[model samples]
Target chain A: MANDHILKRFDEELERLNATINEMGGLTEAQFAKALQAVRDRDTAIAEEVIADDARVDALDVVVQEQTVKMLALRQPMAVDLRVVLSSIKIAAALERIADYAKNTAKRSIVLAQGSAPPSAVAGIDRLGRLVRAALKDVLDAFADDDVAKARDVWDRDEEIDQVYTGLFRELLTYMMEDPRTITACTHLLFMAKNIERAGDHVTNIAELVSFRNTGQNFAEARRKGSGALYTTDTAP
Target chain B: MANDHILKRFDEELERLNATINEMGGLTEAQFAKALQAVRDRDTAIAEEVIADDARVDALDVVVQEQTVKMLALRQPMAVDLRVVLSSIKIAAALERIADYAKNTAKRSIVLAQGSAPPSAVAGIDRLGRLVRAALKDVLDAFADDDVAKARDVWDRDEEIDQVYTGLFRELLTYMMEDPRTITACTHLLFMAKNIERAGDHVTNIAELVSFRNTGQNFAEARRKGSGALYTTDTAP
Candidate 1:
């Protein structure tokens, strides 16, 4: 009877970890959304809110860490349980970083609001943000459902985000080259785009973690990098 | 007698892990240096070499992971051993990312070679890369010696890298504003500068990991973000 009670408690603790991860994942999704809205609408108030909410995400991350270490030391999970625990630890870290990136994008939004931001560039960011937000949601769903197939699908979609980002990067460079007046605003937009694209990468990482949790396989080689190399070409005189 | 033999074998395994981590660290430092020299000298050959060498770094990262998982499963380390193992996992991951950023910079260097890169901007990147490479070495030394003090000192030095990066960012903006022809070159330099700055952050993380291994503390709240916000101001008309 005592052994049964201990095993049940371990299950409960594992469930609790999952619940916390889901909670943190939801908040990062919200953070990314607000940050995107802040940039698209030039809403500094919303941007500040995204920045302010980062502390909460960080706190949850600490909870995840404490729980991970506690479980590892006390429960000493093995095999599948161990993999789940390890992957959750990584997923929590990725969520914290995603929140950080959201905060960075919000900061850029505030700065862009302070000046003249080009509508076209902001629109491009909006498109990229939409794609990333969707991917984040998908990855989170995969995590919650323990659905590796969905995670694989999310992983493949990262190439789409890369394509969009590369396209937007080229557009911004052309905007600067064609009209130097837009150079300053375009530069800020450039950073903002990079921030959003990087956020997409974190989301992709979460997807990979979800898959690793299930399969115990390393998917690093399968990733297709975005065309970031294309823009580095010598368009200079 | 049997326990003694098992314990000694565990020690040997731990030592091997440390040896591999140091090897990876040395490679990342060399990769960053070569990428820097490639950018500074506009040498495509050196850049190609950096790009080619990245696969070796990635393979080392895989080895680290395999060892980490094997140790956790077979040895089931505890207390100080657990902390050391966890810190090494993070440190190894950070080194891999630093190598990746170096590879990105090398790719940019190749592109910059095709165009007219501004000498001033290349000089700025060189300065930032030198600072980052030195810090990387110090963190590795601290790791090898298990010296928390040197690790903490390295953590404090990251602020200087931020300052250099922010100053370079502003200078690039001003150059782009004054001379339209240099905008393309300066833009690439800006990305390269960000890459170097990011590598510095990874180094700082390694420093913090070293301290964590010894003290069991998370020093994240103590970080001072550089003046990235300084350049994102209302400099636009």
Candidate 2:
């Protein structure tokens, strides 16, 4: 009876950790969405909100980290349980980075809003942000559901974000070259786009973590690097 | 007697892990130097070598991760020993990322060599790379010697790289605006500078990890973010 009670308590702690991760993941998703809206709608208020909310996400990440460490130290979970805690730490850290990137995109939104520049590339950035936000949502769903197939699908789709980013990078460079007046706004847009794309990468990393936690196998090699070399000749002058 | 033998074996495994980390760190330092030289001298061959040598660094990182996981699973180390293993994993991962950034800079060197672009911003990038490489070396040394003070100094110096990068960013943008012809080469140089600056951030992260492992304290907030906001009003045309 005592052993049963101890196991029940351990399960409760594990569930609590999962709940914290889910909360952090949900906030990160909102963070990315707000940053995107701020960029697309020229809503600096929303941007400010994204920036301010980052602290909450950051605090939750620390909470998750602390809880995971404590569980590892006290419970000494074996095998699958240990992997869950380990992957939770990785996921929390990745979420924190995603939040940071969102904050960066939001910061750029203020500068972008102030400029009376053409919105030629703004649509492109919005599209990129939407794709990333969707991917992040899917990855989090995969985590919550423990659906390996969903995670794999999310991993595969990261290449699509990369392709879009590279195309926009080229088009923006051309815009800057063709019209110097657009340089200031275009540069901010460039950074925002890169930030959003990087956020996609973190989502992909989280997807990989989910898969790693599910299967005791390291999928490091099998995870496709959708980045496709930023130094490609397409960006050359 | 058997317990004594097992305890000694555990210590030996930890020593082996440290040796692997040192080897990886040494290789990463060399990679950064080669990449820096490649950028400064337009040495494509050296840049190619840096790119090619990345595989070795990557393989070592995997080794470190596997060993850390194995140790954690089998030994269930407590307190300081646990922190050491955890920090080792974090440090190795950071080192691998730093090396990847170095490789990215080197890849840009090839395209840079093919162009007859003016050497206007290369000097700034070289300075930034030198500072980051030195910081990385110091952090690795601190890790090896358990020198908290040295790690703290390294952490304090990341702001210098960030300042230099921001200055170079402004200067390059000005050059691009003044002469649209420099846009291609300047863009590549800008990315390289950002990569080097980011590598410095990872070095600072390692420094914090060193401090945390020794003190069993989490110093997440104490690490000043030198990135200051990327949206600073400097690039406004």
Candidate 3:
């Protein structure tokens, strides 16, 4: 009877921990959405809101971390339960980091909105932001459903985001070279694009966590990475 | 007598955990140093060594994480013990990421070494890398000694690194604009400088974890961040 009671309490704490992480995930997703909207609409007001809301995501991250520690200390969960709690901490941190990258992208919008950015650059930024946001949503769904296949799909798709980013990087460099006046705006756009690429990396981090939660092992080999021409040149393969 | 025995066992496990983290920190510092040397001396061999050393850091991170979870699950540590275990996981992950940045910096050295990089740009990168390596060392020492003040010192010093990075960024852009022939080399330097800056950020992350472990509270207010001119222009503040 005592063992049964202990197990019941453990289950309750696990549910609460899961709920806290889910809430954190929701806030992070909302923040990223607002950030993307801010960029697309060139609305500094929305950008500021996204920045302000980042505090909330940071706060929720703290809550998730605290709850995971509490569960581990109190319940002493083993095996899968242990993985879930540990992964919760990692997933929350990844979500919070993704939100930070989104905030970073929004931060650039203030400066970028002032300049006359080219239509092609703006479209490129929007496309990359859209894909990253989609990946974030899918990873969250995978977490909710404990779907390893879905998580793996998100992991595999990061290569496409990287390819898009590489194209944008070269395009921006060309613009700056042609027109010195475009340097500042183009630089901000480059940072914004890099921020989005990092957010994609964080999405993959969450995917890896989801995989760990469902399966007891990490991916056996190095995950496939798209060729980054910037760093790959001159390397002896 | 039985209670004393349990406490003794707990102390031993905590010591093992601490030792593992310190070892990880040592490896990370070494990687960053080799990466810096690769940039300074243009030694691709050292760069390759740094890249290969990264796997060892990754392996150690997994070991620390597994040990932390095992301790939490088996011992159900509370109070300071609980904080140590939780923070160890955070700290180990931070160290692993720092190593990654080092690897990234090293990777760029391969391409940068192939071309004629400016002596001044190389010096600038060396300076930034040195400071970040110092910060990593201090933070790790702070962790080992549980010295919150030392950790806070490292945290506060990150601004200097950021200021250096901003100056370097502008300088590199000017170089590229003045001489298009310098573009490729300057671009590689720019990425390497950014990698060093990011490594500084990871150092601060470890500092924050150290502070939290010692004090059980995060910083009272938002951590002071150096103003980034790349993104913050004409903002209605």
Candidate 4:
């Protein structure tokens, strides 16, 4: 009976941690979207808002990490419980990085707003942004339901983001080659694309964590050869 | 006496972990230089070799991480010792990411070599590579000697890398705008610069770890604004 009670408390805390991570994930996704919007619309005020909001994400990261450490130290959890704690640490780190990327995008928005050249529409950044947001959502869903299949789907979708990035890279390069004046704006766009690409990777990391939590195996190592969606055929519907 | 014996063993293992990280750092520096040389000289073989060697770095990362985990389990160390073990895990993760960046650079080198347009000289990549390599060296030195001053210096040097990345971003944008044909190669160069920028950030992470290990304080929280040179400065000597 005592053991059952202890397990119940662990499960409760795990659920709490998942809730915190999901909250952080949602905020980061919104920040990413807003940062891109700020750039596209040249909204300095929104850009500043995104920059200021990063502190919240940073603070939450510290909170989640501390909770994880406390759980690990106090509970000395094993097996699935241990994996859950470890995954939370990694997921928090990924969210923190996503916030940094969003902040960077906002900073670039400010620069674009200040620049003389009119901001041109970037071909694939918006699509990439939506794709990353979806992936993150899926990962969080998988965490909530402990659904390996959903996590697997999220991992597979990363290739679409990569393909978009590749096409965007070519387009941005062409713009830069055509006019030196576009250099500054195009560079910002490039950074934005890179940030989104990294965000996709973080989503994948979360998916992998979900899989580990379910199966008690390191999915990354077992499937290292076929892990990343680097060369998948694009059939996104 | 028993506690002293365990402490001695723990310290020895910590030393070994530090040594392995430094070795990995050295290998990555060499690989960075060779990747640049291959790109500059169109040496496909050297690029291929760099890609092949990435597996070695990856393997070392696993070994170091396992060692750290084993030490943590055995020692149950508190305070500074505990921080050291935790830092080792983070540092290993950073090193693995750096190796991934190097592999990405090598893969792009192959693509650039195969492309019809000649690989134009990129002015900022080499400099950025040098900056990242130097920062890694400084962080490792700080870890080995437990020199808080050296770690502080590493933190300060991160700004220099950010400036180089900014300059590289502008230069690459100009290249792309000048000729549509140069778009693919320039995009690769841009990714390379971003990789170096990330590697510099990892070095800062290491510096922060060193401070935490020595002082038992979370440097991320304790440090004042603009005190650690994380991402604000434009120049470093």
Interface DockQ per candidate: 0.31, 0.33, 0.39, 0.32
Question: Per the 3 Å backbone cut-off, how many clashing residue pairs does candidate 2 have?
Answer: 0
lDDT, residue A151, candidate 3: 93
Model 2, stretches more than 4 Å misplaced?
A1-10, A215-220, A226-237, B1-10, B216-221, B226-237
**Candidate 4 ranges with C-alpha deviation above 4 Å:** A1-9, A115-120, A178-180, A217-237, B1-9, B115-120, B174-183, B217-237
Superposed by TM-score, candidate 3 places the C-alpha of residue B100 at a distance from the truth, in angstroms, of 1.2
Residue A210, model 2, lDDT: 91
lDDT of each: 0.84, 0.84, 0.82, 0.73
TM-score of 4: 0.84
Task: Kindly report which residue pairs in candidate 2 clash with one another.
Answer: none
Taking the tens digit of each residue's C-alpha lDDT, what string does model 1 give over B1-237? 987877787799899999999999999999999999999888888988998899899899888877876677667687888888878888998999999899889888887887787787888899999999999999999999988899988898988888888888888888887887788778888888888888998999999999899889856755555343423321111
Q: For model 2, how does the per-residue alpha-carbon lDDT over A1-237 read when each residue is reduced to its tens digit?
A: 987886787799989999999999999999999988998899999988997789999899889967876776567677788888889988999999999999888888888888865686999999989999999999999999998889989888888888898888888888889987777677777777777888898998998999999996655664454235535632322
Model 3 chain A weakest 10-residue run by lDDT = A228-237
lDDT score, candidate 1, position B52? 80
lDDT of 1 by residue, A1-237 (tens): 987887787799899999999999999999999999999889989988987789899999999987877776667677888888988988998999889888888887887887776688889999999999999999999999989889888888887887888888889888887777788788878877787788888888999999888888746755555333433321111
Model 2 chain B TM at: 0.94
True-contact fraction in model 2 equals 0.20
Write the residue-wise lDDT of candidate 3 on B1-237 in tens digits. 988888898899889989999999999999999999999999999998998789999999999978887787678888888887888888898899899889888888988888988889889999989999999999989999989999989998887888888888888878777776666577678768877888898899899999898888765455665244535321211
**Model 1 chain A: ten consecutive residues of lowest lDDT:** A228-237
Error of 4 at B124 (Å): 4.0
* Model 4 lDDT tens row, B175-196: 6667657766666777677777
